[model samples]
Target: MRYHFLSLVQIFLLTVTTPVWAAEQIVLNYKVFRESLSVEEISRFAQTGELSSSLKINFALARQNPKAVRQYLTQPVKVNPVFLDRVLNTPLGNVILDQISQVIHTPSQKADRQALRAALVLSARQDSQITLIEIFKNYPTSEVEVDGDRLESAYRQLRRLQTNIENLMGV
Candidate 1:
C-alpha cells in the first residue's frame, strides 16, 4: 500500500512537471535563432549592425507600435485589405523588420538588398497607420492637444515615405 501511494505521488509530480517542461520548449523555440550564434559572432556584429539598415529602422518603428503586433499575431493570415492595413499599422508590422534584419548583410547580393529595401519601406508605411491608430486608442485625451501644423507636417513626411517605397517596389 505504501508503494502504491508513492507511485501515485510520482505520477502526480510528473504531471505537474510536464507542463513546465513544455513551456520551456516553447520559449526555446522562440529564442533558438539567437542560440545558434557564437559569442564571438555576436560581439563582432553589434546586434543592430548584424541586421540590414532598413531592418534596423523597421525595428525602431515596430518597437514604437505595439498594438500592431498584438493585432497581427491574433488575426488570421488572410489577405484582406482592411486586416492587412491593421496588421501593417500595428507593432506586428515589426515582423517584416525582423525578417529583413535576419537576412540583411553588408555586401549583400544585389537582388537580396533590393528586395529587402523595398519590403522595409512598404511595411513601414502600411504599419505606421496601425501604430497611429493604436496610439490614439490608448490615449484618446491626446487628440485635444493636437497641433494642426505639426500634424500636417507629420502626415506629409509619412506620405513621402510611402511614395518613395512604392516607387522602389514598383508596386
Candidate 2:
C-alpha cells in the first residue's frame, strides 16, 4: 500500500497549503458592473496618488472620487496586536467581522470571517497601524472580492470598532 500512502501524503500537503495563497487581484463589484485590478496597481496609486488608465476607467465607471478613494485606502488606524487579537476573539468581534465580511471576501465566498481576521491581525502585527490597503495586501486568497457599493458602510463599521476599542481602553 505504498502508493496509497503516497497519495494520502500529497493530498494532505495540498490541503494544508491551500489557504497560503496571497491576494494578487482585487475585484470591485458594483451593482451593475465589476472591475479587476492588480494589488500592485492599487498600492502604487495609494502611494503616489497616480492613477493608471485601468484605475481611471474603473473609477470613472464607478463614479468614485480619486482623492476620496486614495484617502480611504491610506487612512491608518493604530492598534496593538495583542489587544487586537484579544478583541477579535470576542463575540462582539466576531459579529463585527461577520458584517465586514459581507463587504470584503474571497472569490469563493468561503472562510470570509477567518480570512478577514487573519488579514487584520497580520497587518497590525507587521506595523502598529492598519490600513485598508494593508488588509487587502495581507488577504489570504488569490482574488479578493469587494462590494464597491458598500465600501462606505465598511469604513463606518471599522470606525465604529475603533471607537468602541478606544472607549473601552479610555483612550
Candidate 3:
C-alpha cells in the first residue's frame, strides 16, 4: 500500500511538473503604412533627407482636404488574399484581428467600410476601402510566428510571402 501511494505521488508530480510544449509558429515579417508616413513626407525625405516644411506642423487641420483623402484612398493597391486567409487563421493573425475588433468597441461607420477594413487587415489583399499601406507608417515591421500547429506548407508559403510584404514596406 505504501509503495502504491508513493507511485501515485510520483506520477502526480511528473504530470504536474512536466513542461508543456507550445504550439508551432509560422514566421512572417510585414510593414503597415498609416497616416504619419504620408507619401509627401516619403518623397521629401527621399529627395531632401527631411520632411516638407508643411509636414512640420503635422496638424490634422493642415493636412489634405476630404477630396484629396478620397482620391488617395481610391488608388489601386495589391495583396495576396489566399495568403491572407491562411494568416488570418493563425494565432498571430487572430490576435491582430482581435485587437482591431477591440478598438472598434462601438460601431459608427458604414457597414461596408467596416467590413472591408476587417477583411483587408487579415486578408492581406487589396480591397476597395483600404490596404496595409494605409494602416501603418515608419512603424517597426516584424516577422510573425503564429502559435499553433500548422502544416509545413503553410509555414513555407508564409516565408515566401514575407518577401513581397517586405518590399511593400520599402516602397
Candidate 4:
C-alpha cells in the first residue's frame, strides 16, 4: 500500500511539473545567414530611397532564413518580421536596441540585429495570421486601427508565401 501511494504521488508530481518544464524548454533559437550589416549598407539602402522595393525583398528573405534556422534547431518555431519591427519600433525595441548599442554600436549590433531579423522573418513565414494578432495585441492602443489592419494584411500575405515554401520543402 505504501509503495502504491508513493507511485501515485510521483505520477501527480510529474504531471504537475512536466508542462512547466516543457514551457521553459521552449527557447527561441535564432540564426542568421546575413549576420552582418554595415553602416555603408544601411546608408546606401537609405540613400537609394528604394525603401519600398528593398523592404519588400528584405522582408521576404528574412522570412525564408528563419525557417531554415528553425529546422536546424529542430524545434517548432515561428518568426514574424512585422512583430519584430513593431516591437523594435516601440519602447521595448528602444530598450533592447539601446542595450545592444551600448555593448556595441549600431553597426556592431549586426549580429543581434540579424538574429532578431531572421527570427521575425521566420515567424511571419510560419504563422503570420497568428503573429499579426499577437502583434496587434501588443501594439499601443494609441495606434490607428487602419494602419494596424494594413500591417496585418501584409503579414497574412507573408504567411501565405511561407506556406508555399514549406510545401515546396515538404516540411
Winning model by lDDT: 2
The candidate, 2 or 3, that scores higher on lDDT is 2
- Candidate 4 wrongly placed segments (more than 4 Å): 1-116, 119-130, 133-146
Worst 10 residues of 2 by lDDT: 12-21
Sequence-dependent TM-score of model 3: 0.27
Ranking by lDDT: 2, 3, 4, 1
lDDT per residue as tens, model 1, 57-167: 433543423233223312222122333344344554444423332333122223433333333333333343422122222221211111211322333333444444454
What TM-score does each of the candidates earn? 0.21, 0.85, 0.27, 0.21
Q: Is candidate 1 or candidate 4 better by lDDT?
A: 4
Q: Give candidate 1's error at residue 62 in angstroms.
A: 31
Lowest lDDT sum, 10 consecutive residues, model 1, at: 21-30
CA lDDT of 35 in candidate 2?
Answer: 88
lDDT of 2 by residue, 1-171 (tens): 355455888987564434476789999898789989899999999999999999898889889899988887788878777777888889988998999999989998889989998888888887777888887888988889988778777777777777767776788
Ranking by TM-score: 2, 3, 4, 1
What's the distance in Å from true for residue 80, model 3?
1.2
Model 3, which residues run further than 4 Å from truth?
1-64, 98-118, 121-171
- The deviation in Å at residue 5 for candidate 4 is 44
**Model 3 global lDDT (CA atoms, 0 to 1):** 0.35
Give the per-residue lDDT of model 3 (tens digit) for 4-28. Answer: 3458888865543331221121121
